[model samples]
Target: MPGNLKDRRGAGRHPAEALTCFCRDVLTSLGVPDEDAAVVADSLVRANLEGKDSHGISRLPIYAKRIRECRISARPDICIDRDGAVLKVDGGNGLGQVVSYKALQAAFPVARETGIAAVAVRNSNHFGAASYYCQMACREGMALIATTNSPPGIAPWGGKRAYLGTNPVAFGFPTRREPPVIVDMSSSIVARGKIILAAAEGREIPQDWAIDEEGLPTTDAEAALRGAVLPLGGPKGYALAVAVEMLSGVLSGAAFGPHVNNLYKDGDPPANVGHSFILIDVEHLMPLEEYYARLERFIREMKSHPKARGTEEILYPGERSYRTYMNRLREGVTLNPSLKSMLNDIGRACGVNL
Candidate 1:
């Protein structure tokens, strides 16, 4: 771990404040228009606030390169056209945050009318954690599923050459007034971003997370980057990853496989990333209060169940992150020394100290 691991000082920031800083400094440095930068930055910082470090500020450098290289548009007047409950959004190569946010924002009203709405986006870059948007929909009493695809970072089942991005999927559901149940995960054994972070920190990666260049598993981050990551559960994970690729990348007509430039290598233009978001109004199934009450009961049972002999406690996804978020609220967000330096560089380029 970085020296700051024990120091909660830079653990996390307030959702709103971190959003502003990331937008103003990081995106602005990437040359995005002020307004567009704000949109992109807000979502990224919100990911951090939710304790998703892999999808947070650590992604800024790669996003900036995309912007500076014209792979991502700094100013996109996105076109969101609706076909009944479906929305097709042309992102104009804008930051994924701006495009995805606008698409979901528009989907909200459409879902209200039809009890469900879905949006597909094309020509956009990475949009941070998918749960951030799902959580947004959950706040409105909607069950949401979000997915995004990137350039190929993993090999398909029974295949060698990398042909898929990690391809994350998120599902968010709200029951009554309790905290929403949010599950966000990548189909790959681990996020490529997390591997990059591990490499940067000179930390050893887990062997199962990736394979070496020789097609063997390795615990070395450098070797993993040179190789491919495994699927979550063999064929099942591969199937899910392929599904995401089709829905997000193929449906949106974005790039796929190795043809897409690697975000860390920082060469070549962005592959015109794509994403899809779905929102379902719980009111259509049943009243929100009734659904939530039942959900709360389920949660109570699951959380209060007897513990295994070796296990201390059982936790649903997003539980640990919530604790970190609460603690980090009192302590400032922590940054690795190296990351702090990079942020300073962006600040200097943008002529702002934030």
Candidate 2:
């Protein structure tokens, strides 16, 4: 990051100032309601601070364009229907992050009462990282799992054509001695948003990450963008992604695969997507203290285990992000040149230059 910030040819703004500026300037330009815009801005900033560059500030241009086109609603009316332990929502085409946050607020009470609760959200835009919402329940000592479907980018097993979403999934649970165990991953070998960022930055992709139209692995970013992302563990990952599609898309009655809207594609309707979240009150299953105590012991054993040859330690799933969060918050986040330029353009258009 030392030399990265010194790379003057790229995004050349301090991370905090850039993120704050982007959130305030771009969301307002899109005509998002002041309250909802605040929520979206906060979530996007957190993504950057957490070191998830793919889901962070890079999305402002696409989202701003969608708003200008009037495809996505600026102030969608979020609705919820309760069905015992489950709640269904129609986002009214609002920003998915805000809609999902509203849904989670409803689910938290239900989970506390019934021991568990599930929320299904349909007719929404990209929600960014699912963990941003799941961490809510984790903070309340609840175990949480969340997922969302996306545009066609992954291929189903036994077929070459893309027919599934990268389908990001996330989970988080309380731990007494460490940061909450929050892990988010896409079912694909690499996240589609990551590829988009790479393409925006004019970088070459690895051959194993995706395949071209002919179904052959490639190192070309343009080819990979038009092709399908490989699965994480072959069929198992494909199956898992489909499961997410069913739970988030079909279960919520939202579109999936090609039916889902592509943020990069203009002249297209919102693809009217959907997503789902699950919350489990750990105290209902087991006492909260006991649950976390056992987790702490488990993490310590794994960390102190003998190293494999030159390896230092067997790091946990989310340990790296907590480290990144601490450092980035102090050192500031990095933005590529293209991303910075887009931010300036958005600022100028919005009449709120940074």
Candidate 3:
């Protein structure tokens, strides 16, 4: 393992609940309502627990700064407009986490009645992860397909300059197991936030992740940030990104491509990110018990199929995250030196103690 990776592995860890409390305190102090702040904090902390540190508390400072600048509404007046099984949500420029949660909440009842429902959200910020909303729907016995558009970070395939965001698509299905089966992936080889996290820690990224502005592959995190993240499967990933942008950005009537403001850039306009969600009542397709039984059997067969040389076991989508979440709940979540210092600075600035 790299020295930086080893060091991070040995870094100080904090209990998940404590970190969530700290995040909530910081947001609440910045004029966010208690409920909204808790929702955001829980989403961040859950990301940490699931081992997605890039989208965890590391983003709190930026969120706080945006809230203070009035770029993100502290108390947004979210509005939902319904058209049969389709719903349109105007986030009122509220925090993405809160707005997405509310949008999903509004879709569930309609989905239950209509068998399937879709919600399109506009004027929202960056929601932590698409999987979070999908999983929420899964827990309610609904299968969910979710997608979102972000600030420009990845270039369209065959191009050098950025024109498309590292859009993501996620899905979740309830199973007989505790954690629902979930898959979440960005169209890029890696999520843009991971690159930003590496830059913050002064760690180098893999050379294949991104290319410098000059269209040369670089491992330097700072240089990569100035460049564009590469698509996951070449043209296929690029195509998927465009599809997500159409559904999330154009369909939702939110800013698309370069029009979306950069979330990390300080003086920019509000990040008018967009998200789209589709919920299907699984019970409508088959009996819940039969569906769960068949899914479990399929998972079992896949896991037992075979293991290649040097492989420990076969794991399915969301299985690794489920294990990480369980382990973190008991062993606590680790924070590297840089992240710890950043959190401390945020706490000091906000008159909160971590």
Candidate 4:
């Protein structure tokens, strides 16, 4: 857990299924197709299940507002241009989840045929989490490298102005019996969404997370929002963010750098976010069984290493999130008081009982 949210409390617990249904209903009421609504709802709820509450249902209000304002199309005329194993998809201002889902569906068969496939998406809104697409590809016995560019929030290597996004990237590798190895992370020191949540909760942010408008460190969430988030490892994260922008934005023919519209604040223009997906079929390189055995062997050896003091079991990249998902599935998803109120408000507006 991030230090900012460690002290937060929940209002109550609710079934993940129920939250999904409510989100789906709210989206459908706003003219989104039932199937598309379900896809976005499931993606958001799964984030919550995996303990990524920052990208979970907390984002629905902005989505709803955007939908009502005609910024995000209810039914996008998504078009795909294919060239060999590469695909370029134009989202037509559609919801990011729906557009990305369609793109992934298109990539699956191509990967199977060519052993590898690349999909570049443009004119999309904010997709919930990159891991959702990684997990989707992993489920089909494929390794995936996925990335998405968001509205600019992070500064360049030596600049104080916000120019690059906290571009998120995810990698997923399948295992025979163990949970898939999933690594999802942002280029910033912390995700900008976490700061947004802190601001919403009226909490002070860690000084390292972001800076004030004058490029000085501050604990005020609002001030941080007005400034820029720090890169994860300074220049290293800035370089990664540049790479992600190239793949997801420049390569996809979408808005990049500061050109991307903000999802929460910019209401006039559509947020033409971009995403890139690379899928590799395991059997293409070697037999599936052989790959699984090699991967599991590596994992076993790595986990068996001696632990430092106060260290418990050493788990793989996705092990912790996988455990959280399982536990939350059984115990129910918890919502903070503000999130609960927000959802309830959306429910009332959409005529759906939460």
Candidate 5:
């Protein structure tokens, strides 16, 4: 975060396709198989297009660092154990996106047969975005609830020290005549990745987002990174985060809370992050057309309601992100100069120019 690297011009747009190619090539150079590399690359670039910049290609540098350190196995021997409609997966300390993608694929047929299915994954690293998997489920005509435990970045309610992650939970519900409703959110007021991105961009955060080491609020991104992020709504968010830990970490038999290793700080130990997914096959529950009709009617009613002052229009959970994705796909994603510089540096290390 040196002053010289900060670009005052804000950000510059870049083609998503080019970024995906660069990300895939870099991972492949690090010994990741081409197919898996492409999966990770597509997920990262999709985040950028969806306006989730915190989980975008800006993360490739850290992933590359972990791969080189041997903390993340480039060719992990992922193992899956199934019991009826339930699945238990061991990721073998692999990239999270790859592990999660495989887990979802394994759940598809089981859910179709049983009406619902659950997949618990362990020994995974940072997954770019929870919504990515949720969207995949939607494409399979399923409703999915997905959650993941991350390295600690938040404290328990009324506590001063970091003890819980800003664990994210996502829900994807398919609808007729509308984009899938995807509600993807962190238990914290904001995701910790945003603070990391802000620090890398030499920008200050909103004071309410996180606290300093002394448990006081701070606008400094660096200080926030050193401390704990604030939960979404005090006790409620704290409880939600704990629930996510139980579902993703405890149930999956993976690292929970403080046990998860820091993605950047702990280079030697593999981050034993965990993820859980619940998939419900719409056709099995009710006729797909009937379910879609009900959902569309509900959305129409919700959107027709009167809006509060300053509100332009009501939007569904994933509507804005879907719009952003379309616009960015047609145009391009805007990358801050610092991010570009970091990506270029990673490219240089991998002997691939961005």
Candidate 6:
């Protein structure tokens, strides 16, 4: 919690499974099939477990609304078009988690055979986090590079108006002796969902996160939503965002930049957002055991290096998220009052008791 959100928030904890069930029930009631709803629910809950609350259960209400408004299809006939190591997925305007998960699953066998495979998805709604898909690849002893484009929320470097998404890029690699290495980040300084969450909780954002409509930095979350999110590393981030747009949007033949509909605000027409995934089978390159040993050695040497002032032990990219997931699994996920209330309302509307 930040700013006034700390005072206004409620303290409530629930088992992750229970929350998942609640989410599934709501989606199913909205005409989504049981399996599809489960995939979507699990993705959201996993985000919470991984300490990425911005991509977590807070999105349920909006998802339900979109489904109800026919902006997102409840029962989609996802189709695939494959060409050797390349695959194209048409989500049929379905829930992103369900659509993207299917695309990744379809890529795995191709990657295993070809050593490398790529999947491009179009007509998908907002999927939770890129880490989820990358982690899936890691579990199969593969490395993955994933990226997705969203509605315009970030400006190009040196520009004042938004023309690019807070596009996210993620990487994941398997390790035998430790948690998989994962690096997931948005091109913007922070995700747009963080500002939305802050606004929902009546909190203020950090000034550097975004600019107001007048192009001045602001700490107000609402103003940030109305304006644009700043790029993560100025020109560097803008460059990355452009690359992501090319791969996920242009190459996939999906709506790019301002053409992509806003998932949270817009209802008319579908959100033709796009995503791209590249999978490499690590074992295909070298002996799996030998590669693991080398990776472990690298990790050990890095950790053995001197620490910065006041810093504790060095941790790998995904270590913190793995620890958080384990802790939350045991201790349960905490839900703020506002979020809890929204879920409750959704439950009532769906005739499900939470």
Q: How good is model 2 by TM-score? A: 0.94
Residue pairs in clash, model 2: 10-337, 11-336, 11-337, 261-271
Candidate 2 worst ten-residue window by lDDT: 1-10
State the lDDT at 285 in candidate 1.
91
Model 5, global lDDT: 0.93
Write the residue-wise lDDT of candidate 6 on 87-188 in tens digits. 999999999999999999999999999999999999998999999998899999999999999988998788777889999999999999688999999999
Model 6, total clashes: 0
Model 5, 74: alpha-carbon shift in Å?
A: 0.6
Candidate 4 regions exceeding 4 Å error are 1-11
Off by over 4 Å in 6: 1-11
Tens-digit lDDT track of model 4 for 266-314:
6559989999999999999999999998998999999999999999899
TM per candidate comes to 0.91, 0.94, 0.96, 0.96, 0.96, 0.96
- lDDT to native, each model: 0.78, 0.83, 0.92, 0.92, 0.93, 0.92
Report backbone clashes per prediction. 8, 4, 0, 0, 0, 0
- Per-residue lDDT tens digits for candidate 5, residues 60-131, read 999999999898999999999999999999999999999999999999999999999999999998989999
Candidate 5 ranges with C-alpha deviation above 4 Å: 1-11, 266-268
What lDDT score goes with residue 264 in model 1?
59
Q: Model 1, 1-354: lDDT tens per residue? A: 224633534443233464467556767666677776776676666666667777877777677766777777788779988999999888887878888888888999999999998888887778888888877898888999999997677888987667888899999987565567889989998888888888888899988899887778899998888888898998888999999988888886777666556555656665678899889999999987788788888888999999989988888777777677666555646667787677767667767664
- For model 3, residues 1-354, the per-residue Cα lDDT tens digits are 224533544458777888999999999999999999999999999999999988999999899989989999999999999999999999999999999999988999999999999999999999997878877998899999999999998898888888899999999999776578899999999999999999999899999999999988999999888889999998999999999999999999999999999979978999999999999999889999999999989898998987999998999999999899999987778988888898899899999998
Model 5: colliding residue pairs: none
lDDT of 2 at 278: 89
Off by over 4 Å in 3: 1-11
lDDT of model number 3:
0.92
